[model samples]
Target: MHDTGHNDVSPELDRRLMAAGLRLGRRNLGQTHPNPAVGALVVRHDSDGPIVVGRGWTAPGGRPHAETMALEQAGDAARGATIYTTLEPCAHDGKTPPCTDALIAAGPERVVMAIDDPDPRVSGKGRAALEAAGIVVTDGVLAKEAARDHAGHFSLVQKGRPHVTLKLAVSADGMIGRREGERMMITSKPALTAVQAMRSTSDAVVIGIGTVLIDDPRLTVRLPGLAGLSPLRVVLDPSGRLPLDSRLVTTADKVPVMAVVGPAAPANAKAALIESGVQVVETSDGPNGLNLHEALAALGEAGMTRVLVEGGARVAASLLSEDLLDEIVLFRAPVVVGPDGVRALEGYALSAIERSPRYRQIDAAIVGDDLMRRYWRD
Candidate 1:
């Protein structure tokens, strides 16, 4: 919240650099597991007056941190350069050396970070080390913006689980699909396209076995040029009822797929799914199916910091009832599927929502004929 460095650089310039760094950091977000996707920029002022010498984001798999890459690019230019970073440089040695050590070794004149590291191991130590080395550390340049930019990491550290989003599309009458496991499209092409883009951006997408049995969806990003960015596909199957010939099982070799089954799952079925390249996660069971707490823990262990649950109503209701959802994305369409349609809340539709965790609308937009609303847990 305070600027501690020298007064040579304008606040506007610092913000611009940090903003650019944040954008760069997000480019590889879903791929940077076990580490936050950080962005860094090295700026040097010459006759041109404050030109960026190097810029980099945290690489995939979290190796070669942002600062490491940027400093390497800056080389000798980093001696008197200023650094702008979205999050505090890590100060602890992890799979790689601490980023703060790299910054100190690089001999930057000043270091500006959007926010201090939330992890206790690094928290204030990064700034302390920089100030101790007389590096003119400018802390909290854009604290609020950076907190939002790094929310996935914050959630992972503070909550001990991934940031979970419950996404659903419902008819005007509040129906999700036709009854009897018949899949129905409630939204138009634009909404579907948006869903694909969202899937591409998240670390993984989850769905209940009910969804798989009913829809047989591929759950992959079909959009051209973006197919490669499709996130991991996770299906919650309590009794190991997932069909071996299902699209998810068949495509497990091409993309990552996890079948989260309950304790009572058949050993033969688990072995068969594993043989087909699907990761069989055996977790405890809940009313809807697999115990979501254990299921999410397994996901976080596997490096998913942000996950999307694209569900069949039962799963959505279960997440809401259990207070497991961190965010909600609802698409309200104009069409009605009538009384015979499936309710969005399974055995408990829109009624008794007062019993569920309250949510505050954070954003809303019109996607084709659907009204898309985003909410945060209140």
Candidate 2:
């Protein structure tokens, strides 16, 4: 939607820079799920004009990362180019090499960074590395925008835990489902795409048995070409009640965990699921259903620091009950259904909600007629 046709570095250039920035940001999006949406830009001058040499961003499938891609594209021309990027470059080694090393090796004249990496792994090292190389570096260019794009990932990096998001699709009167147990699509295409985008931005997607039973949804990313790039699928079915034929069980190839309460799932349950090839893990249960704290801890131990909670009221209440939630993201549709139906949070008592997690407002916008607000948990 942004025009990058004009030259002369006018507002148009800024738009193009931003659009390019968005593209670069997108590069690291899927990889940083559980992290933040980060991108990079390289500006080099040639004999003809200010030749923008390379546009490097993070890639899908969570490999190589942004800085690596940027350096690969910049090769040789990086000597005097300015590297414009969203988020602070990483210093610690991860799935790829350190971003700071890549920048240093590229020999850029300057580095214009949008926001600092909140992950303890590279809180300040990337900048330190660049400055140490005697490169002119400007930190925090378009910092707010960078933070807005990667609020969920930033929350995890800063807090040392996943950004807990709570999404509920309700009726005009605020009921989640109908009295007769019928559930319909409450959000439009944009909203659904927004949900899919959230999947693309998170390390894992979580839901309870109720939702699994009702929808049997794939719970995977399905945004055009972005379908295969999705977070790990997680189900909270303490009773091991999820149907074996569910699409989530059949489709997800990643190590899917089913947080259950019993010592072991029933023989029939195991037989049904194993026949379809889905792994199940049983852990201690909470009074509600699943032990959310244990499940979250297990996820973190398994290197999943960020999680999204797509709820069926009871699950939302369970997470809220443990006080383990880091953030809350509620998508309230314009429609409303009256009382006598499922409330947004089903089991928790209003008076019992004592310690509400604190969050900082990041951005609020209308994405194709749907209101989308992002927040960072403190």
Q: TM-score for every candidate vs. truth?
A: 0.92, 0.79
The sequence of per-residue lDDT tens digits that candidate 1 reaches over residues 296-323 is: 8888888788898999888888887788
Q: Say which candidate scores most in lDDT.
A: 1
Q: Kindly report the root-mean-square deviation of model 2 from the true structure over all alpha carbons.
A: 5.7
List candidate 2 segments past 4 Å from native: 1-23, 32-37, 45-51, 92-97, 119-121, 148-160, 252-275, 323-329, 347-378
Instruction: Give candidate 2's error at residue 375 in angstroms.
Output: 4.8
lDDT of 1 at 250: 93
lDDT of candidate 1 vs native? 0.86
Enumerate clash totals for all models, in the order shown: 0, 13
Tens digit of per-residue lDDT, candidate 2, span 130-200: 88888776665566666656665665555445657776555556567665655666766787788888777
Range of the 10 consecutive residues with the lowest summed lDDT in candidate 2: 1-10
State the displacement of the C-alpha of residue 221, model 2, in Å, after optimal TM-score superposition.
3.4
lDDT (CA) for every model shown? 0.86, 0.66
Question: How many clashes does the backbone of model 1 have?
Answer: 0
The prediction achieving the highest TM-score against the true structure is: 1
Worst 10 residues of 1 by lDDT: 348-357
